[model samples]
Target: MFSNAVKCRQIHLIATSIAHYWPLLHERPLSTLTTTAISQEPSMFVTSSIFIILYCGLSLMLCWCDYQSGLLPDRFTCPLLWVGLLYHLYLSESTLSSAVWGAIAGYVSFATIYWLYRGLRGYEGIGYGDVKFLAALGAWHGWSVLPQLVLIATILACVTLGIKIIAGRKRQVLYNPLPFGPFLAAAGLWCGWQTLISPPP
Candidate 1:
């Protein structure tokens, strides 16, 4: 009888415990629980994170190479352009037609500016490599954002030049060639991150 009573008491405690916790469990919406579960898991964002890292690594590498050598190698720029197309094609993040048009526009616009500047100044104001780099950026971001990207890069480059002139670091700003690739790379990376976080509608 004592043993039976003890078992009954344990059962009663278990029931009470369940009753106390049941409201807490039931009160949580399934969506809230699902969200919490998803938040705790990092694998869901692994692919996006990898892509972001790859984009950043490539952009930084190009930036460094341009700063050090004043050249943007076709090896890097071409691969970046192709990969961007492939990214959009396979990922379906954007239409392949858009990427192609972007690349065309990017190249033509910059090349036009390059030739016009040369015609007016009798010298090349921009390198061919910079043109290719901008094309690669367009491949990744599409033509929609190209204007903003160029504007940002131009603003950044102008600001840097202004600072250098103010600091008396560059006496002959026109004579001293400034590599535009780094500024373009920086702007591209910024736009890339923005695209990754919030894709275009």
Candidate 2:
């Protein structure tokens, strides 16, 4: 955990204390509270939705911080990932080995593509941020859908490039680093859902 995260957590604690003591504080609960007002239990979908929203918001902030500070801070990213992986491991206890291998496979697939680009261009093609994101995705969803992620990312990039070309915004076929992480993550989720709903041979 990063130092800033520690400070942020402390601030949150103080705010919670203030909110708790202040009877005037009245934040509406979005879902039915369990047995107590302080149960801290929302509907599962609501909780998942909030988590996803927070992840995207944090990812945007992290991306901006990376652009500004030239470094990826672990404050938000690491804890969320660690907890997510544990959640995943617990949910798929019988397939823990598959998840571990899937993570490795996802990393290898993406890293291999990354290296291939580097070799052909003789320059740094992908950044460590992308590498880490892919690794995290691997850990989250495993490797079975990694190929779909790559395919979808490529199609999205091509479509983006096509639009740029059609609009006459640029001249060269420059392979700019777009936010491929989101597409990969989204595609993996879609494919994973499909697989879960329709198991195959």
Best by TM-score: 1
What is the C-alpha local distance difference test score of candidate 1? 0.83
Q: Write the per-residue lDDT of candidate 2 for residues 1-201, one digit (tens) a residue.
A: 699999999999999999887654443333334345446334434554554555456556555665465444567446535544654554446555555676677667667878898999987566555666666555555566667767876787678778888988665545444555555545555554654332221
| Over 4 Å off, model 2 | 1-81, 172-177, 188-201
Candidate models: Cα lDDT each: 0.83, 0.59
Listed in order, each prediction's TM-score against the native is 0.73, 0.57
lDDT of 1 by residue, 21-65 (tens): 998788778869898879855653665466566667777888988
Model 2, residue 72: C-alpha shift (Å) = 6.0
Local lDDT at 199 for model 2: 23
Backbone clashes in candidate 2 total: 1
* Candidate 1 structure, TM-score to reference: 0.73
